[model samples]
Target chain A: MKFKNFLYIIFLTTYYSFSQENNSSINGDFINNFQSYNDDPLIGAIAPEEKVLNNAYLNVIYTKNNFSIGLRYESYLNALMDFDSEFQGNGIPYRYITYTADGLEVTAGNYYEQFGSGLILRTYEDKGLGIDNAMDGIKLRLNPISGVYLKSFIGRSRTYFNYSEGIIRGVDMEMDINEMLRIENNGSYIFGSSIVSRFQEDNNPKFNLPQNVAAFSNRLNIMHSGFNYYIEYAYKFNDPVGSFSLESNNYAPGKALLSNLSYSKKGIGINIESHWIDHMEFRSERAKEKEFIINYIPTISKQHTYTLLALYPASTQMEGEFGVQADIFYKLKKGSLLGGKYGTKININFSKINAIKNGTSFLNDSLNIRSPFLSYDNDKLYFTDFNIEINKKLDKKTKINFIVSNQKYNKDILEGKTPGEYGTIQSTIGVVDISYKIKKGHTIRIESQALRSKPDPNATKKGDGHWVMLLSEYTISPNWFFSIQDMYNFGNYDQTQRLHYINATFGYIIGSNRFEIGYGKKRAGIFCVGGVCKEVPASNGLNINISSSF
Target chain B: MKRYLLFTILFFFLSQYIFSQEKLPNISVKNLNGKKVNIQDINNEGSPIVLNFWATWCKPCKLELNTIAEDYEDWQDETGVKIIAVSIDDSRSMSKVAPYINSVGWDYEIYLDPNRDLARSLGVSTVPHTFLLNEKKEIVWEHRGYIPGDEHKLLEKIESLVK
Candidate 1:
């Protein structure tokens, strides 16, 4: 009730003050996801007590000349499966007002921000992953000089309907070397530095902890011709916090280093990246989890699109990790022997991650898990992947894509499973997709995927057996689309465990409105977008989705 | 609380009556070469412009762009239109964008909005969102999702505008 009253006050003030502006515009978007569930014995899916679950969002933005006001209304009623139950009822969780003029901009209420590669600070929203960490506060951006940019913010990170206990404050500056020095060469250089600090009350009874924790990052970028090199190093002060996964209280200062080099031309591109991280997770509320995260360590692995290949996607560890990833993309010219009538595009990627060695043996309790730079434990491998993908146009009317992937996932280490419970999974995946345009305004696409796993006596349910999936989609001009897919665990030795997940869907799109409905069985697995991940439970259900913007 | 909610609903509807043409804001986005380019400074040479917000990992977005590529040259010749592809890929995937677009032979101008600042300002929460601008560079039409053969509808919209 208090929040409502506050908003009412802000709304009236803005409306009455801005009513005189004639060049005003209002825009918004709405999305709703509804699901109805059924009990599935084989997949271990039980219907929720409510039987139906839904999540909906509506965002409205009003803008006129140099001022804007926006708000987002969200309703979960009963949250969907795999969604945080804390998102209970409905409220306006995001609202902001902004004004900009003459190279100076100010935003108050709520905003998202990021600094150089997001190593020390990044706040964003990924609706698909149900992660929105927008900060509610005041932000100022200024470009007083041509080659210099400055930003500063002080706020509290959002956690559902509430805000984190800690207060976050950050400042960043970026300077362009060429513009600052008046150099005339085409080459480019930009240097940036950021400092982020969080303040929370120290309430622990057992140990003394710092009430204010600060982190700093320095970054540089060089771009000349087709080559680009970038790096950022971040260091965090001593912060004693809880690690939920390890079930331990940690007292350590954290640090991270990330670098990337890439070269791109008309027909080819190559990139190499490396990261060394240690206990660098910064959250607005130290004891809280994903909801209060204040920073993001950039992920380097290739995010696969195929179902089987994506099953073992890589993610960041909150404690310590070191990894390297590389990718190469090339295009075979048209009329060549391999390209045939059209050009062929090929991409190859490799990534590996390992745990960093802890320096606890030599350090005191206050800095217990601090490790030296770039040294990783040889035995604690986390994940590794190598994949190749090829896309080609067979003719004017048809296109095909092929992907082959190999991965080794350490389930025991990643999931924090104790000894004898699970083991590593060594698997290979292959996918083929073909899209054909029957004629103008009509198209059909078919995809097939296969995954084979090496047999191991200690394998767990996740490492069970081989799987195959097939999908077909048909579309009719500008408005309608239909698709069907089925995935089967064909290699399961136990007949009762061999289940087929089948689904079908159709969608209609008109201008800015989209409507989709589907009924299907969904297998339990980890769903990830970018580097963020979440576990989804198996279910059988009917889903309806609608979105519109105006 | 109910009264406040009711007031907001009424205000929202009342503001709907105040609609007017709005142009792109004066926000900065980086190009492939890492130089900042203000959104308001892009010049289309009096031709219609189409800005498509996309990401590297979105399948529908890729499909939409590829399908449009097949007729891009002809469409430009007919209506003098060009697409400016704005990528909303975050820090992790931003580098992959330049290579991906080049390897796929897309000639569209590519800009990076790593923090999604441009997208948020434009009220674009979904990928494959497309905006069509008139010769005056004012957004005249918008589309949220892409379906097969959507390019033809886009072309029709462009032709009517240019006519």
Candidate 2:
């Protein structure tokens, strides 16, 4: 491993030399201008890692006039971290050269694409999750007429550091009927429809999954004085697979139906969404595991950010579930008793999920498992969380926010590995966040929260109860901050279960760079980004962090 | 069989504990010496630190990092600071980190966290999940995701500890 790293460094040095020469000569004028500026050498760059097993990639973007090109050269040092270093040997992960002009766009090579809320088709990359499904091929967009747009693409799905074998072709058309009709009127409505399909030969004999799968979606947006509404519906056909089923003889194709509706005006906005999925598991390969999920289920819950409040973030079950979400935002005008001088804002959100009921005919079958694949009678996985937040500016130097939330979750299905043991779990979390600016250079924030969950069979211990948390952040101008947080497990089975974890941190900043050191006891939980999350471990240790940019 | 099941459960919990205890990745970075050095060695090296990731074409990244570069010296004087810039630039732009630093005259320590191995291990899904580690090499705090003016917030955290 060490020898390979040395060789890798030599290769990088040679490659860097080559690129430098190439860049210096290709864009002399641009480089000269960029160089003319007193670009400070002390500008921060990416932070240093404690270890460097596999070398990282170099990404470069150059743009001249209406043309722009991006190239990323990646190298995997060693498969020491969670990432697969082998990707480095797979060649450039992403390289796209494109040009845009006169309402027309063209791109060749690898690129990420999303269409109309991304319900039907969304080819995205989440490097953190080691997921990159960028389409490798060609894409074109043209707007011949105002309010009428056209987009088409022919490519293959991105696999692990490479493109898939199947061919994916798609075309999308969107028309703003109001604009097309040239109506200078209020309450305008626009409608659009799109179709995306994937074609691959069915080579697997055991499952005989459909090689050619097509899905379509339609959307409508309406606007009027103080109110706007948007809705979309999408559906996919049945495609049996060995992974989604226990036996080929009992294989069943899957489908999904989704819709979202919303309205907003001035200081108030409301949104409602619903989704029903039946075996809608789509994958690039039939044998892929949880890592190969191609589609996502939009969760319906307030994504808590605080340590204690976010202890249990909801994870969407892809196999099948019925879910709904509602959100409302309203602001009270300033000068009112409730609004205060600077105005106040209020936000409320609720979401729920449940299993879809199924027939009992297969109940006697010993082959069937009750937990992971529970056959529900109503097929409804009901979960709901309602949160209300009121924000008010107490004075010029202070602002306060008070929030309360009630949530119900299905622990048996949500966290349970089997079916018959499935049961619902409920929890409540309330928090108060207050920010006070002591002066121009000093600010302080205090946060207090309480979380309680009902006893379930899966509880860490019998009668597992409630938790309390307190956190404070003090900040001073230029580059100083201090924070301390504690979680007190006050309720539940064991009196000894009352665990207190506390942490304090200090940071210093020089320019765009920052360095911080901290010590504390931490708990274990899941950390999520963009609806996808990973489990984070608990640790009691000292930590150092450094970040900079240039 | 029963004993085996008990062992498997114990193993699962033990692995979880160890995995959670796993610290951030370490790098053997060269300080323009071309001689490799571990990142932990830089602690208490007597300079305020700056760590940033940049590519040739990340406009926002260049803009944010450069904006800080313009005023880095003043920040250093006010707070004893040292900055280290690590390039996520691949083989294509790997050479650019040096010249880019030189041409830009960014007097910060520079290294490479290529293939984003470190970034992934740190749960850095986006370009700027910045962190502030104290002189003890302990990660005091971190923030994931970034927008304009986020640097100011980061500066506040650093400034609070300077005194």
Candidate 3:
């Protein structure tokens, strides 16, 4: 056995042997999914040498009083077809030891943290998307006074199994004005500020590069009885970043401003959010793109739940994009004529993103990078979406939902296509969902959805075509569920390419444990959780998943 | 190799033993009003409580919460239980949570776990994961995923705790 494995065995033995006499507690959870792949030339799916791939994660945490330590073991046996190939090995990538006492906390090792809406610095792990930016080092948090909070950390971002080359140092402080001033029954105002600096060795051969790049952000939040407003502004020093150019060496300052306002009542709510970002692509490595980001630029777009509506999820354009979103939700009173027996709920959402206008000397003169007006060039539209939905309960046994959406996606910009190559796509989607309670423990749900889009006439027919999907799910309360779904591409320009993707699933749950078996021809698409996305390739496979938690 | 196998077997048994006595961690989380409170202090005054981990963007999480909301009043009256919804929204969508809940008219205590500190401590990897705690705050039962009728199972689990 490897030395590390041997050490782990010895440690486990000692811990378990002495656990009966101590009050310390150890708990863990695990999830494993295995798939056997079959290649299909029609949809471009390939099988690896293993023919079968499995992804498993195990997390165990040991807590004793106010101190705890935890670690996660992950394995990707010849990673799945669509997942990142860098995760084709097993390792203990996450481990941390933390102690808290007397309003003070300290952590050493891997940790995830966020400061002020994560505009400037946020480290987190989203295993489904294969994104774990946990910082590896030390963090300290202290609360000296009743309403004051302070935290500071210095670390290197974790990349795959190794740490990044750049060193990250940051501090954040938040103060509650109401609490600090002891103002009773008054509105609450919270103020926060953060500063983050990254230092990377200058290795570029062509031009001068900043060895130390710094970013700072400040935020204010005011809340009073159903009214809330939050705003944050951030600025980054001049640094050369990857902007899809290998030969160009340009340094530019980055800036971002995000704001949110909301007013909510008993049954009605309205919120408006807007943000402007300019040259704000910050990464641990200037040459890296997409994955190794140092800051998170929130996608100010609605996260659609319906399958058809989510087909064209929006990705944030880090270079420069101005976006705004608004949402309104209202509920019809119960026992009213339009409301039926129960209340009817209606939701409307709209969002738009546009490319920011750049100055002529933005690349040549670093000082000219700043734009005061934050103007967006109307000619270049990145994305736009507007959707509305209504949910109603017809009777005690039945419920229904109706939705309609209109979306315009810039294929050239969002998908990284050549400029003016694919131009844009305009799509309209409609969906209907109905669920009926047949008995106390038996229920059935049916979902029908369709998407119609204007395809690019200049290119060969592909995914940008009219599509329809039908899904039916049956559930036996508390234990079992079965589902079958089919998605048909009926408007493919090429006749032979039009096909139906079908899938079936069976699942059982028993007290914190779940087992599922599925057989399906999966479609090629981008699956997004919350703006962060992963591309899943087409596959014909038998899939099995097991998960449990304590 | 045999030693490694033995370690795995021992771990499996040890995990089983620990899980049977699993209780809520004392991780701190923020309430809807932005006040900090420890998870261990969030009891239902000796009544059963349901701890649900969810997010605003998760479809199944919304469905599960909505379904439970429809019968929450009756569930509370019958079992004297409370349901606490913990949102793992993070800073990305944390601003929308308050409005979203108000608009949906869900009458459940909501908490914000921006960094997922509480979630990681509790080993919750995905949303729509729920735990049923008895009067003593010991995790008696848990379930993952939510279908249309999953709330029936939750109600039954709470009833079992009462029994």
Candidate 4:
């Protein structure tokens, strides 16, 4: 860890020098344009109870014509999140220089890369999520010919505060069949394939794990007339581990398979996806903890958007599961009664997932010390949601939209807690959203939603009941806006526990700078961005903001 | 007719090039107080807008915003710029927006894109996915991650546009 920190600092210093030279044009304007604020003594010590320690970073990118190089300097005040204490000192987390010429791209030091669907091969980094699986090795991308592409890389996966001990390597090639085969005149069809393998020496005595593991996948996409279709299938080999079995003598690696199919045209679309896994647990380091898994298992459930509808979200169980999902979307064209003046869109989706049932039946005479693994059951342990939306032009100056949703969710598994030992719990939710344009530059939106669940043995006195919410926003054109919202817990669980959250805000826009102020009472909830979520602590206070570019 | 065809082809290519400029998708988000504002609606009105995703709990995010607050007025006057600061703060710190902004003295337009539905749709994986959109509502450029001094470069971009 000490060596890693030393190397990181050197990299940052070098990058800083490089950026100073390359970014000379912009640097001059920056220093001349903005004023710096004096450091506030309280800024560092007045840490909020719920907030992570403060960290700061500076990054500069200099691009001249087609060549660009960038560097980032980061300092973690006290080693935030899972960062090792060894790396507490301020330094550069990553600094890389790259150049692109024609269709070939090359990068040295650090970079992020991903292959089709990221199934088998992906080396992306997300600093906010504490995920940096970037390969610290050479990467080569070559479009040798007009229709064919090739990429290869050899490196080590980024480990906490350092690179992994194991060497990682992979190669990828994709051919645009339509262009490569010169069939563009007869419509277009594209086919591609990829294989990724990893090798790591194992010295642990508990099991004799295979050092070399490989996974492969194939993809196809076709477009003709007004319709388009895409499909991909992937499979991984077995690799046993301590987590899989307690019996030291009979352990074997696991296998997995996944596939997706979709078609779309004009105003109609359809999608179907399926996944099955025997024991495929892919991770950057097998010895690492479970939460540090680099790869992911796709869930078949639909991701909800509305506040109440998203109260319960399903997390993919990586161990063992088989599932399928289907979605359909259609729209009534403009001028039709259902479509109104603009158009009416209808969306329907459903998904189900359950453990794969093993075929072994219990024997009456057997005194087996080890129970057979549970097999998939006909019993449904999943969730489903349906919604419809109507969009219409009320008049020359006004437009309106309405949406309705109904959802059913599996509670026990999603929430990771249940009231009963073996029984499953289900929840139902509904929501309504409406937006109206009262006049030019003026609009208002309202949303009301609720959720109800069956009383569970573990439920707190509140029998499965209901919740209600009201939100309204009024925007006045060009310079000013205001909004108010309230979430009221009207459910049966505990009436007195029912809490109401309210907020009101105002904003002003001047030139390129926008200023806003607000006051409100908040609640605790998981805030998600692109499937990545963060825990936000509840607070009650005033807020102000100012921002501008250039 | 041939001339018309040529004109049509040129128009098609031009429009395609103009629209495919890597701009983030237009999304409606609520202000800190809960009013809905579409990102494109602001950018479409001939104002270059900076859309920054941030969180109250994120220390770096606070620093980045604070840094901007100190220089925002000059940036706006020189470049006809607007900053649409979108807070990803969840319910826990949702009410802290007004006081927080007031204390920081930032004069940027502040809105709360809570739940991050809009952020998800736009592939915003982290805070500080600062996007620079032109007057035509096209995303001209974007940078992921931020550090101190990076705002200076952002200002340079704005200056280039204004000039």
Candidate 5:
């Protein structure tokens, strides 16, 4: 055993020295988030018993000559206050080895992949959302011919540190007609198809569930000089799903259609997107909600960056919803009337979504709600937004951004309340952001925002009051930044109960390393990444995050 | 435990020596024209390249690129440096990238990493991540997170390469 150990050590040394002369290399990144909770009565923030919670992740990869291996180590010391308790452990849950050749590649262990806009399958990671559903099996990617691509994978979806009970398999293929058919063209025309399936044993006592369910998707993409068009349609067979309520059953077929058309140029752009999803909630394990998501529904709503504008962010309804969004962008000339000294840019966006019109399923009336294609339940509007933004630069060192928007959010649907329980929250929001450079290496920015909410006489929601936000940030070139923000629910119907949520943060960055610390009162609400959301209890805390990449 | 420490330190140094001039991984990203292009093919007539990792929803990323846009033409004329913006927008906002870039009237080349495959390969955890490459396409310098006036440092790096 001693001789074997010596030989191993010798081999490692030789390998290390040889790597220095070869193309072998290593790269990794690290991130740690630590927070200390404290009780607060104002915002109803509560301290967890653990007092301090932490989450850390590290990724290491080594590569050499068409071969690579990677592993991700995650530690959640009782998990953070916002994360699910199931992730309260440490493990190397993600590890993979991949080999690449001229036209083929293979990966084993864990991998993230997607197919055709991810309407059918998209396995990825979002640390903030506590989601990492990489498949733990094998994947194959092949480029058989010019402009032809094929991919297939068989695996089990990861849930925290463990794999789900269901087995997932999928295959995707794409062909570029211009290249495969040898057609002469200045644009690209591609056609793709995908099939994703899941298998799990059915032990439900109330209903007979499908042991295997498959979904198929077809898409087409066309791109010209300044115009692009893409469309995808997906269909899934009737499968009885047992939700978190293990005994309940919903046998429904799923269908989804999404399309986007856009045209753009140097100074002008316009786009329109529409999608309708019906009974399309899919998971590797049918009982899991957002935990083992085997597919991703594109959230068509605009992603806002302003502090107040993001409070009532739109959520995608996976069961049945139809939505459409249109965006228009135009830039006025530098010297034009509306453009001012420097050019001004105008952006207009409008989006509307409604519950799909449905009736008893003709095929299975007792189990499913059937809806016609593109059918909209006009009375059940889920969400709607109309916003416009104008950005202009007054001089070389001064710039301003102004936005005004009106939105109607169905609180009942978005917050998972009973239908019509809280009705709709309609509000008008306005924001102004200004930035000025005082010196070559110094800058300051100020943002002010207001949201006017129409009160609900018969509802019970905490934050529907009129809100105003003020923020100021000072950045010292290349190194440090400090910001303070206050969100005040000033015009609450219950005037005595109004609250101000103030937070302050400081950060420093040197090279590829960054460190940030903050003290704040967090709001209690549904925290979402992309369209997936989870409720996070309110917490008063001091938060620190440090990250480094090499 | 001491032996393990030795092994770790040795391997760390070995990696640095080997990857001091590491090239981008071989991954495919979609150009603004919605066509697949290999990472090695994105360049400007053998000039130094700047591969910026950004996202459509990231405000700082937009700020960084917008700040650089003001002097892009002059920088190109002086150092022949080309800026290539890689947006890691998922399917949720992939379709908006082209319009967003065009409305800003930026002349830089744009690529889309819908699945963030390229971003992951490059060890980019945050948006507004910038990488500078020499004529040989080897990553020479990288900076994470963008602060106002940081573009000057980037310009300095490019100037040194051409000088």
Candidate 6:
């Protein structure tokens, strides 16, 4: 079938379905983002090959009964400034048809699935980072009995516009014991297990590889009224990865353990989580870096929304890392001494990650290489964060939130930069947010933030020093909103490097459609989603975004 | 392969026109307490339901929920209704969900769709997406994104259903 003819068939079918005006529904959404770039040598904002770029996506879905079909059309005219150039053309990258009937569901084409905590398998998409690892294949889900769910799939992970060389097959089964037993109870218990295998023909003549690798995960969840606990363990067979030479073989089996416990009652909530993984980098194509990932290793850290605080995010070290995090939330009742007229809320969070102690005697070999890591040790810190925030309403028209945080970041291992280049970054951050209601439908919010970090003596490795930021947002009842924010690096050791990033945004919304336009300077940083990182280059320009759904 | 996918989609589009029904999908999601819930059973005691899909990182979604929370009591009194706020935050931010909800003190029933199965099933591509369901548990209306006064429009829809 010719490509043009295929598109014609799609359009014709869509038109016919719409013209019928029957019980069927055709719904779609479109998002168009256009940006004009400007070059600023000072901040290293280099002009792209194209001065202006547009990234647009359209999703259309038709559904009737237990049958549904959807397709996503993506176009990157000249590709966004920093997006991979391979996405410069227009294509239908995602298309799937699913049918669910008689307690069975089947999908063919493309789909996303996750097993356990995604320690073993996860296929997903993140449009902001232009990463879509969706599997193109057939999937089946069955609910043969009450409270029992079974799912299996066979497919190839997507890599850009093409599919990877590895063939993937997996099956998962989960059962809610309480529900299956037909017990009308307050507490529940669930158990799940998954097995996945991948196959790829070895093409490297110099090294032998495992043509087939399998992984298995077992999970358990127990929930009582206000308490919840979940635990999952995964193991992977030996798989050789990374650069390999004939002189030495680098192959290792992978294993991970993850657990989370939480209790929430009334106005108090507490959660604790820990994870340990070793030799757990699982990917479809071993040669592909930063892409074609097959499994997800989570980074146990708070996702900071503040600009300065987010500058140095912790990236999950897939090779070997042990981490733990705890969060506490408490709310004071209204009319209490410290609660004022409205209740006051307090949140405390702390997280730390460290390099696992290697099994091999490191006296002879340098520990810098990825091969030596096997066991976990608490002495070497990879990242640490302690933060506390308080939110209170002072009066009927005013509210305030204050936050303080201390952090330790190791850039060398996390970013794969030169070892000992910047050593580690130790910093403190403070934030104050205030919201005031001028009238019933009028409101304004102001945010002030400061970040101070210890600077390195080396000029080349010196980090951006003390920073301050202020943001203000004003909104009127329904249709209009405006915001202005600025961040300044005032204490940089090199005065010439100190710069300010100022941005202003305006938005208008009508029904299901929204339009936003912004002009600003975006600092260079790593934007991450689900532990996947993408480099966002520094740019100064005008950005226009419009999205509508029907 | 691409041609095959296109052909499959076309086949479904044509077939759905003849048999499509306006009932909500029975996709499963998890409540804030980690209990599995079927979207089809959200209609409690045959009451109209407001199904809102949101995320913690979405500014507009937060604003919409906050605005609705402030007036939820009056709205419920006027028309007996229930609201189910679904969060599509992936596993990356799922841990913070319970604490975040407590801090806001929203009384609405909340659920987590970590993998977005329900969102995809409902064709929701953006945050702050809302759906209004009749007493029959059928989706009657939906709107995406939110402005400050969207709650008013939502309340009106519920009132019509109540009548």
Per-candidate TM-scores read 0.95, 0.65, 0.94, 0.65, 0.94, 0.91
DockQ of candidate 3 compared with the true complex: 0.53
By the lDDT metric, which is better: model 2 or model 6?
Answer: 6
Task: State in Å the error of residue A273, model 3.
Answer: 0.3
Ten residues in sequence with the least summed lDDT for candidate 2 chain A: A27-36
Give the DockQ (C-alpha) for candidate 6.
0.36
With a 3 Å backbone cut-off (N, CA, C), the pairs that clash in candidate 1 are: none
Give the per-prediction TM-score of chain B: 0.92, 0.75, 0.91, 0.81, 0.91, 0.88
Model 3 lDDT per residue over A379-491, tens place? 77889999998988888889898999999888777777786677778899999999899998789999999999996565443444889999999988788999999999888
Query: Interface RMSD (Å), each candidate?
Result: 2.1, 20.0, 3.1, 20.1, 3.9, 4.3
lDDT of 1: 0.84
TM-score for chain A, candidates 1 onward in order: 0.94, 0.78, 0.94, 0.76, 0.94, 0.94
- What lDDT tens digits, residue by residue, belong to model 2 across residues A349-441? 777777655521122123343223333435445566777867666886676768888777665556643544535556788888787777665
- lDDT over C-alpha atoms for residue A461 of model 3: 31
Query: Which residue ranges in model 6 land beyond 4 Å of their true spot?
Result: A1-21, A242-246, A359-375, A456-460, B1-23, B32-35, B56-67, B99-105, B135-150, B160-163
Indicate whether candidate 1 or candidate 5 has the larger TM-score. Answer: 1
Interface DockQ of each model: 0.62, 0.02, 0.53, 0.03, 0.55, 0.36
* B12-120 per-residue lDDT for model 6 (tens digits): 4555455434567757888864567877767668878899999866656876786687788988888888889999987666766776776567898999988887787
Candidate 2 lDDT at A173 equals 81
lDDT string for model 4 (B61-156, tens) is 764675576578888778888888888754323334444454334678888765454554344555666778787655565655553345766888
lDDT of 4 at A194: 74
Task: Label model 6 with its docking quality class.
Answer: acceptable
Query: At residue A154, what lDDT does model 2 achieve?
Result: 84
lDDT of 2 at B118: 43
Return the clash pairs for model 5, or none: none
Question: Across residues B13-109, which tens digit of lDDT does each residue of candidate 1 receive?
Answer: 5766756665787678999877889987787799999999999888779878987886899999999998999999998888889878877779999
The collision pairs in model 3 are none
Error of 2 at A381 (Å): 3.5
The CAPRI class of candidate 1 is medium
Weakest ten-residue segment in model 5 chain A by summed lDDT: A359-368
lDDT of 6 by residue, A1-550 (tens): 3554365456546755566455555666688999999999888898786899999987777765566777787888978876888877778878888888998999998899998778889887767888788999999999999989999999999877888888999999999998799888788899999999999988777777888889999999898887888888998887765345435555557778888888787788888998887767778766566687888877888777677667778888876788899988888888899977777888898999988776212211233333333356766788899999787768877878788999988877777789778767889999998888887657898999999999544424877788999999987756778999998888887899799999999998766678999999988878866556778899999999998765
